[model samples]
Target: MARQQFDLIVFDWDGTLMDSTAHITRSIQAACRDLSVPVPTDEAASYVIGLGLRDALAIAAPSLDPHDYPRLAERYRHHFLLTGVETVLFEGVRELLEELRDRGYLLAVATGKSRVGLNRALDEVQLTRFFDGTRCADETFSKPHPAMLQELTRELGQDLGRTLMIGDTTHDLQMAINAGAAGVAVAYGAHPVDALTALAPRFVAENVPALRHWLREYA
Candidate 1:
């Protein structure tokens, strides 16, 4: 079978291009511990990979009252900022972005993270220059909802059929499906290959090298 191709590549921020789960987990766990709430395990944290902090907290700490979410969220942000200290682009991610950008592939990020959070990480890593722009969950936009991608497509003037969305979660896959773009799931981050395969993404890669190979052919 022939490999699929695309002209624009959209990425999910946290687990796809950045190794942020450790910071994410640490922040969430610290906040929960402070509130006397049970801390979620690493595996459980993966379930919230493509969700905003507020939504992730709701899912991870469901037993807590909704009224307490704001306080917890504030604490999580504080801890994350102070300790979200460790972050680096996954090996070969920077090269892959450079290759894609040089090849005339329009690059953008559509993440469930908030604008502030995404921008902070991007700035820290000096990667904000790589993307044309980003669509964040803080703008009342979340993955699995086509609005962000749709808005991005319109803003970038790219054809939806030639656009591709890549990430490590079902939320990212569903966003592609909903927005009429191709979906590529990566297995090396938070989710296992079998789990990502279940979603039937157009392509799936196990690591940054594999992803770059596939994107070179597909993009």
Candidate 2:
């Protein structure tokens, strides 16, 4: 076997692992509507999928006062939870994770979800055991800030240079750049393929199978 290039594999939650991009975007739009704030278009709403809820709401509803953020967030959660059960991991994600685990790689998740929400999702999908460590937006700085990856590396005893961050959005790629980790992008997610490609990640995968294949050969 070839030597592994990375020791720690960090994944972004929404668009990367779980197929929750549309649900989240709808929830954000619904929350904006509930607040009587102008609803963001699907593109505008989906663009914020990998950001912390607070940060996402701020971008999706910039016309609203900061004081109403909590209310907007509440509405967002309410709508999200209503359809949360519909979310699922992308095809082949389980097989990929299991293979990685069997091959002795440390796997972790760096997500925009609150700790509570991430736990719920993990529990719902029964995927908690596959991850060695997890970081939530509510617990620290969100994506595009290196804090999540930095903290995960510290917690897992992995080198920044030997870490691989994979996701569907530019935020994930930018975070890897900020953390000095390599990044892989997936096109079938919240951001457009062109946007993800512009980040110059190690590779841009078009689907879960392609991502899995690449990781098998290179991760």
Candidate 3:
């Protein structure tokens, strides 16, 4: 296909690129436990994977006082940063990114992770060079908000209509819609397949290879 559409391809971190859903879910639960707050079920915890940390904690632990959000957030980070609970990129993720970059597609990240978190992960994986620009929740509006996409497009000199957002959650799709851009969903990530489908993304890939195939033929 000769790259017929989309000049910029934006991705979400955590569940989308990294196999960190379980780690994140566990961390959130552990944070709640540490605070002696009601712990969210596995599903409940995982559903907030693509949202900013505070927003996700609020939804996962609605009973917690707002003043304690920082404490919960700190506990969550502490749990996540522990050695055994670490996360890694999905199989073929690095290769897919390399291929896309070589194909001359402008790659970027619009993730719920804070700038420090995303930077650390990218540098640790040595994948930081693949992205031309990146946006984190702490520096701007979080997922499902158009500000990140809007700013990325403007900074990269790309058109919104020619931008593509790829992620594993509905928040990612809604952000694409709000930004007037197209979206592609991956079923292997955080949100359920059904939730992502309801947004009517351009395509829903089942896994990393399938996603690679889609991009090779259509992206």
Candidate 4:
């Protein structure tokens, strides 16, 4: 394997590492129903997966009143927390993260989830220990803005050239671009591969196993 090219590996949580797209979509729909607003289609809901919750909700259900955003967000969270939703990390994800950590790479998460939501999910999945740091959208600017990645790199003292962001959406790739960091896009996520490819990521992996291989060989 080639020597690691990145010292810090920043990951996007949903659709990239965790298979939570379905759960999130359902939650958005439920929130719309709760507010008596027109629900967005699954594709529409999933399209906003990498954005901050309020921003996502606004885009997904544009007809909804801004005054109802808090309730909409609350209902979404309520539905997401319901039992049996079964949000889990993609297969091989834990192993991949562990291997990267053991190989002396610093791992972190830059997510659109709120701090409370991210913490709960991390605790639930037992993945908190794997990350050296985390930045959440509620605590900073949302994706495509680069504030989250900027903060992560600044806090970790990592150079932009030696930082890599891996995610499953154009928003993620754009965030990397905005941060001046390299990115790898994963296909089996919210955005289609073609859309992600247009952003010119260093590589596009079709699955978790392929992503692992790419990181091993080049990242």
Ranking by lDDT: 3, 2, 4, 1
lDDT of 1 by residue, 1-219 (tens): 333577678999888999876777777888888899888887786778788778889988888899999999988888887842777789999989888777777899998788877887888889988888689887856778888789888889988888889999888888888989989998877777787889899888888999888877756
49-161: candidate 4 lDDT, tens digit per residue: 98999999999889988998889998998999897776599999999999998888999999999999899889988999999999999999999998988899899998888
- Per-residue C-alpha lDDT of model 3 across residues 1-219, encoded as one tens digit per residue: 378888999999888899999999999999999999999999999999888888999999999999999999999999999975555899999999999998999999999999999999998889889999999989999889999999999999999999999999999999999999999999998889999999999999999999999989887
Relative to the unseen true structure, what is the Cα RMSD of model 2?
1.0
Cα lDDT tens digits, model 2, 32-95, are 9999999999999999988999999999999999999999999998999984257689998899
TM-score of every prediction relative to native: 0.93, 0.98, 0.98, 0.97
**Judged by lDDT against the true structure, how good is candidate 1?**
0.84
lDDT (Cα atoms) of all candidates against the true structure: 0.84, 0.93, 0.93, 0.92
Kindly indicate the candidate among 3 and 4 with the higher lDDT.
3
Those runs of model 3 whose alpha carbons end farther than 4 Å from true positions after fitting are none
Off by over 4 Å in 1: 1-4
Better of 1 and 4 by TM-score: 4
How many steric overlaps are in each model, in order? Answer: 0, 0, 0, 0
